[model samples]
Target: MSLLRLDGVEKTVRIPDAEPLTILRGIELDVAAGERVSVVGRSGSGKSTLLNILGLLDAPTGGSFAFDGVPVERLRGRARDRTRGASVGFVFQQFNLLSGRTALENVMTPLLYASGRAFWRRRALAAEMLDRVGLGHRLDSRPEVLSGGEQQRVAIARALVRGPRLILADEPTGALDVDTGATVIDLLEEVAAENGAALVVITHDPAVAARSASRYRLDAGRLRPDEPGVAESDEVAA
Candidate 1:
């Protein structure tokens, strides 16, 4: 079954003293559970905007988003939060860890947002997730003491804590060096599959996109599927 779907979605932002800008215009896509989709595009092509809409961090100005067989735009407040928590996980370029909190605490934050679980139950689950992400030894360390890769691993643990059905990653490796970035990608793909979650990776690097099962590219505010034979290196930005 399709875990997530977006149809005819459009998003526009209005500046205080400037004209409006349309970040995503009538975009459509479907992601099957356990499928890995790579969204590739040039800078300013709305890939991140698409990720935001899918992650439920931002709403599209028009059209609809269906996640795990539920319509999303019409939902608000707790209802939307409930669905997003149950179905979506997000990883970003910067690991947005809480500076004052330990890595375990940061990962536990998302589970706290989850509706049904009690604190003690979620706490145990969070620790297991951090251990799976290979940061078991640093669970009590705060973000300031962790390396970039370690911090991102914490972010990944946070995303997984809710047991989400879909994983939306926006330039997750953008801030790390190439080797570290690849290792991060490896962990992401492994965990997503292990959990049976669909993966949507939005990035500007074609080489990164190549790691996925399928790829799409956005240009000039529109999205399209690339020819099957397209090489990841060939899609690299000039």
Candidate 2:
């Protein structure tokens, strides 16, 4: 089943006395559960805007979006927040770990907003996730004391703690050395796959984009299949 669907999605903002600036236009995509997809684009190519929409952080100005077949337009306010929190996980280029929090604490933080059993078993679950990412021994280390790769692993553990079905990684390897970045991506893919989560990697690096099962190039707010001679998947909008 598809975990996400986007058809003719667009994002536009109005300017003073100027025509509305469109950051994204006619975007179309679908990511099946447990599938890995990559979107590669230049710096100003609306990647972040698209990621925001995908992660439920913002709404598109037009077009259709659905998560597990439920239209995004129908999910309002707290309902939207709950869905985002419960079903989607995000890994960022900056790691985004809290400074004073220990590794275990950082991973446990997401559960603070969770309900029922998740909040009650937060520590155990967080520790399990960190262990899954190979950080079992660094549970008490703060972000300041960990290596770049370790910090990213902590971020991944935090993202996975809620057992989200979709993992959105935005330039996830941007901050590390090539070797460290590769290791981090490997861990990210491994853990997401193990958990049956669909992974969407948004990056500028060709190598990074090539890691996914399906690939697309996003240029000038438009999307096209990256594989040469491969017919564009119907998942792309007409």
Candidate 3:
């Protein structure tokens, strides 16, 4: 089933006393449950803006966007926050972990906004997630003490702790060495698949995008199918 749907989406930012600057135009994309997709784009190609929109961190200025069959535009304020927190997980290349927090504590961060018993059982859940990412032994390790690969693994554990329906990874391997990055990506895909979550990796690297079953290119604020067998007509419409 389709977990995410975006059509004719646009994002524009307004500066003081100036005309709005358009960052994304006519963006169309769809992701199905348990599917793996990738969008490749160069720096300054608006991929980050697209990522924010896809993650529900920012709303589109035009067109329709839906998650789990509900219109995102219809959600307001905290409703949006709850929906995003429950359904979307994010991984960044920089491994945005808290400086002083241990691996386990960092993984438990998401439960801070959680409701019901999930919040109460946060410690066990976090430990389980950390173990899933092979960091159980490092539960007390701080971000500063971990290697690049280890830190990213901790970040992954934190992102997946809530079992988000969609995993949005933005250049997740950017800061690691080639072999380490590949290993981490492999682990990410395996864990995401095991959790039955759709994975969307946004990167400028062709090799990274090639791992996905569906490949698209983002250029000039538009997305087009990038794989050879995928026809131009199959491009995501806007």
Alpha-carbon runs more than 4 Å astray in model 1: 16-18, 115-118, 227-238
Best by lDDT: 2
* lDDT minimum window of 10 residues, candidate 2: 229-238
Which ranges of candidate 2 are over 4 A from the true structure?
A: 228-238
* Lowest lDDT 10-residue stretch of candidate 3: 229-238
| lDDT per residue as tens, model 3, 1-238 | 5899998988878889987777778888888999999998776668888899889998899989999899998889999999999989999989889999899999999999998988999999999988988888999999999999999999888899899999999999899889988987898799888889999999877788889999888876778888654423332322
The better-scoring model by TM-score among 1 and 3 is 3
RMSD of 2: 4.0
Residue by residue across 156-217, what tens digits does model 2's lDDT show? 89998998999999999998899988988898788788889999999988898888989998
Model 1 CA lDDT for position 65: 81
Q: Give the per-residue lDDT digits (tens) of candidate 1, residues 112-221.
A: 76655545578788889899988889889999999988998999999988778889898998988999889988988988888898888998777889899888987656
**On a 0 to 1 TM-score scale, where does candidate 1 land against the true structure?**
0.89
Question: Count of backbone clashes for each model?
Answer: 0, 0, 0
Over all chains combined, what TM-score does candidate 3 have? 0.92
lDDT measured at residue 215 in model 3 versus the true structure, 0 to 100: 88
State each model's C-alpha RMSD to the native: 3.4, 4.0, 3.6
